[model samples]
Target: MRGTLVLISLALVVAGVVLLRSKRPAWYWMTFGALVALVRIAFTYNSVMEACGLTVPPSRLRLMLARMARREVPPDRPPRLLRTRVTRTGLVLRLGLRPGQDAFDVAASTDRLRHSFRAYGVTSRELRAGVVELRMTGYDVLKRVQMPAKTERDVMRVPVALRDDGSIQYRDYRQIPHALNLGATQSGKSVYQRNLVKELAPQRVALVGIDCKQAVELAPLARRFSALADNPDDAVLLLEALVGRMVSTFHVIRREQRISADIPDAEITADIWGLPDKLRPVPVVVVIDEVAELALWANTMEKKRRDRIITALVRLAQLGRAAGIYLEVCGQRFGSELGDGITMLRAQLTGRTSHRVNDEASAKMAFGDISPDAVLSVQAISAERPGTAIVGDYSGGWYRTRTPHTTLRQAVTTCNDTAYLTPDLPELAAFRPVLPPLTPAGPPSLIKPRPRPVTE
Candidate 1:
């Protein structure tokens, strides 16, 4: 009982200190705290008396005096550390940071904090300069830590964190196009893809989807997709065509290069930004679902396809930047064992999004080498929230994000509305899977004689 009471006392003290450490509240630590201290000391009195064998009866007032004897003195002023902010867009959030801290440190610490708090439906990133952006992950535990700080935004871009001027902070992700998404099944891996697709659907970018899962998962968003491939064969074909398109596009820019003093400064570059509206090249965002499946084949024919696929993927990762071809590859796990190509591939993808995973390895595969605490955070993601994820990109840190559930129906509807945006590319249409044609039924089987009359 004595030991238990002592532990409780220490805990209470620590809790109070931690709570008051940041905020500027003097009275809270003074008057009200003094009263609480008195109550706590009085309870400790019985133990003290029992141990010391004192004759004096311990009273609340006496305990109050004892409490003050050991209380820590208030600091002169609170430490003026950098301030932080949280902003929301739908279920996604953006985090902003203080000036002194580097983005990496803040990102790592934020990853630890997210782990401790189990910020499910929470994905945070640091923006250019000193901002952290977050996307709400799909999970329930996130509600516990971030509920009080939440501000809802229905738009695609969520300025989750704030600036010194209290304005909405944002970042241009196009600056880093290659992204790697890693997580185990049922851990919100799929949710990240959904979020990206939803964000890019309305953009002028062309969408290329490679779903090794027979397109069953991505088919709903077909209307927005310029090309969708199920098998590695089709994926390879699609990539080959995409690569050809990129080369041609680059050549056109090179051939058309006629920089002059009359040209606007922004138009001096060779990228699509430099072109006229009609001739502007559409950026292609390639999404790979279950990339491991693409690497699993072993036969000679399969090996050839895999080699070509890896080479093409690497080319996109290496040189696709200038060509406006970005790759967003999603997998259950990303490891070096997949091949030397894996290491090369991981380098190109600057953005990383990790949902909850089953093991430490999965987390490590997703995040290069996260703190043990952050790895623990991945395990905390529950299966109930299918759309919640934690995203870590090149800029800041791992963040909790719960991408609001936009059903397949919703995605389909969005795509169907903008189907006209589908580019005119005959190569893509040639390999598209042929849906079965509906056959007309002959006039009732029992009335077959009617057909004979027509023949006569």
Candidate 2:
């Protein structure tokens, strides 16, 4: 990977130089032609200097002009960010490179450039070319990079420098099992979650929501969910059942594994429904609303509940990666204040996103090390920017994305549209919430959509 990335980075340099040299019109070339006088003087002097004994040839010496030209590109077009913003955390300058320029080349010349960028306050990873192909990450060194929130996108959706194809060149959720979503209340947190859930819902993945807010938050989309947990006690029981189900499925996979040797490696994986009926291992994505609620217990019973839930979450975060059991844990706050094991739980989450938060501390907790400046942006999030958010998957650091709102009605509609696609699984069916059946045990009657409330 390292060798491949380095070669790709160098190629970008050559490509960018070609593009930049070509993009200019004749007048610029005329200006370049004027420099021929100075070029001849230096070229002649260098040729003579090497004539006696110097090993470095004038040909190699001429190539040095490209190196100098490469460095000149940045000083010519310094990014137009606020000076204070530029001097803050992990990045120094957010200059735009030519379409094919490689950031790794710039970063490699002197760790000083990267170090200086970080020293002077710019922190987000350098954005590189290839935006369409990577969808999120395109740069060799920038795969782990993140930039500041200059625009709404930077604050809401992570700007993945892809190859302009909308396709991801790197990892996606199917590959990363755990996602930690952290933001202060009203930080567009729910908006982000809705976008993710909206995408996965139609894919036939069994959606399980743990909404301890009496299911009020996620209840509207019950049509799409295979299970929803409302209160603490019920959520505890539900989670335990999920763990039990996982244990059983693992056993099934193990028994089958004896012959898995005969099967392809691709077939060895297990999910909530992929196990043979024998091993029904369909992938399970558990959406937890207010993980703090589940992790915090007021009493001994709640503590035990918290312990069990934490244990299950830890297991899922640790072992579920291969089993296709993914987690989407959302909360207004996730910190050491929640007490034991919360930090551990947060560690399990590989992907994280934060909307505008109430304070820098919350942002720091969610995005501190990877993006402290991003945390600063999170504090400014308000209701007006409902669908916008900051998403950091490390797929390309953090990006501000405006996740189009997936309203309760829209979600219900989408879920219903895709409900039939949800294959029936006996184990999953056992966990479904009993909603007292919509027909009320009477003859079938026509139903009407509830009318919306009007403003006075």
Candidate 3:
């Protein structure tokens, strides 16, 4: 007994030292968890089975796993634990599946696993053939925003937000040339766009904005924008100007594709990146806020104007990648209700994000093609969770993510700071509205009173 007392005291001292040295809260939780583990181990096979939600006369093989885990070692059968890995987030137990058991069985039991382990959440993924991985989140990771540090220097890839799994969510403009972002009002959709622009501002790319809502969203960042269109008329002109630039860029690419006497035929290419640095045209990112506005029209004349704008955007989305132009189309609702060609434009937007939408229909508009589960997930995002969203791509791998709250002032400052980086596109310059240079305020006209006194 005296020896055991000494051992306990020594263990306490070691734990104290370790906790002092570690910065993460996992250490503190694990110290208490060690005590809980002792109590958990004392539970009988029946009790463990009941706690794991297998009380209703579960299969023999399932009980075998339970007993084996508790070292009960059933007289009839025993399952094996190949390996166990404990991470800061959760534990991974690798167990051999029985004849009828599969990864789906494990996945289906995630809720029960969470309850049994007293974890916040539990998820399972197939590691390989016949092997499954259960990833449990240690805490409510989405409660606090996980801001991504600026690391990517390439204009083609920007770290826009953080995933619930602690991975950086990258908006790779190179891979996904067009994206569809949907969110209801106050659903944190605008915050995600702010984060995207904040990251893109420092890169070598021209920014064009179309905000039919009187530029309330994108106007503040005009210093960094190469073109700004707040009305449909201007939007039409701006889009046409972009199409003109696309044609010019294609011409440049085609001209550069010619093989020189010194160069091999294998080196010939058609993309903008293939061209030499001096000859290469600048990459452009066009942001359209409330794309539904551009698709909706009342009369024939308005319909014609709207059609022109929509057609331009569709063509850009379909053929802009090779020409170094990308689109980030955002809206509250985007569906057949908008108008014709909207579906085709949405089809081109491979990257989709749906925030806390107002209705299930909006969620379906964003994610129905990808996964019905994704649509359900997005629709469930509560209004309280503003920045939370369901983000997915054409790859069909979707996940819940959240962007940190970036204020309008922060976004404006980012653009102002990086305003010098806006690339000059000759075709776009004609459509870009000119603003007078900033002149510092002088003390309110000291000489203005002299003219007024003479008139009096």
Candidate 4:
């Protein structure tokens, strides 16, 4: 009877795990997955390290002692595991490297450690001189993105997506002044832009949009845009106006440059952020929905216009950051094939996010210079996963990221709610979109229905 009861309990436990794995993966990881990973790491760490060549030869003292005792020599020593932290999404293992071992050695063997620990993913970073941190995700975070309850958010930094390692992927303009976002049709590139706009709506920064697709993508959030252009001609004017604004902001910073030998070098002002808050110009984020539209031209006159637009873009990208202006250039594909100045403009964009592209060359346009591994990762993105992307930057690091599914209506609502926060920049006042007046709700009927109607 006891044996039968034991079998029944084991079956029940297995069934529960199967159900949780499909229905509530986070819960399952917190309860069962983490426990199993911890146990596996404890049991197989030494063997895995030895197999991966991550183990170090025994010390001379140990060898001498073994010889003196007339016993077999001790095995090589693996890195000492200092601590193991269990997080909501994964485990963080901190290891102290043995002499002559370094973080790169562990990084090279991350795949072995991942398989040994039975974790979904593993990543390593040097914490200090002799310590390295291994971040292991307990499950496939991109499969069903659930953004954590709290994220690191600040001025000009917004967490727009979740990385496959269960960390938030922030769109930080302060760190990377410009970004190139690429994706084919139906690849959720628009959705990613919406999330960025929604996140920026409540901030004090100014939003400038140049959506040459008849403003189909950005017009819904017109209430929050300080300056918007829906055509190439208008976009050129808008870009010129932004250049003017950037110049004016530079003058302001110069005027406020109270540089003195008494002040520390760090305190000396250079950018808008260094100026006093009252004297600082509001930051501007230029979002271009389709860069190809501005680059494509046939006629000589049209070619001149395209050159003007590209020139303006190149100027902004080359020198806009210090003047409180940043660029978010999005397109289906961006390459030298577009025009003479396309590659020059791309060089200035340090951040890159590539969704499902039609070809490897398109992926290369985004990640080729950054990381070859990222290019491969982007190519592996399936058509079924619209929001999944490979995000990277000049830092030479990349991650698989997926933005949570945000509907257009939700983004529009957020923009409307935060419309009042839009800054009025006098430089581009002419380009500010004129939104229709809101229809007022009618007043309640003053006269009550006749009692005879109720009787009938």
Top lDDT: which candidate number? 4
lDDT of 4 by residue, 1-456 (tens): 999999999999999899999888899999898888888888888998898899899999999999999999999999999999998889998999999998899999889877877788999999899999999998888888888888877889998999888889999899999999999999989999999998888788889999999999999999989999999999888999999988898898888777887877776788999887778888999999989999999899889899999999999999999998999999998999998989999999999999999999999999999899999999899999889999999989998899998899998888877777788999899999999865535876788744211100
lDDT of 2 by residue, 1-456 (tens): 999999999999777655643554222223442244234333453333223221222344445775877643212222222221111111122334333345554433333322322211112345545211101111122222223334222111222222111122222555556877776666556755665565555554678889988888778767668888888777877777777767776776776654544677766645433456434566678899888888877889778778888888888788875666778889988888987878888877888777666667888888775676567666666667554456665544565545444566666666655655455546656657654434344666688645322111
Overall lDDT per candidate, in order of appearance: 0.60, 0.57, 0.78, 0.90
For residues 109-204, write the lDDT of model 1, one tens digit per residue.
434434433333334455567555544322233332222244443322322222211223332345667877777777656655765575556556
RMSD of 2: 15.6
Task: Give stretches of model 2 more than 4 Å off.
Answer: 1-171, 259-280, 380-383, 394-396, 423-430, 436-456
Model 4 regions more than 4 Å off? 1-9, 262-266, 439-456
Better by TM-score, candidate 2 or 1 = 1
Report the alpha-carbon TM-score of model 2 versus the true structure. Answer: 0.60
**lDDT value, candidate 2, whole model:** 0.57
Model 1, global lDDT: 0.60
1 or 2: which has the higher lDDT?
Answer: 1
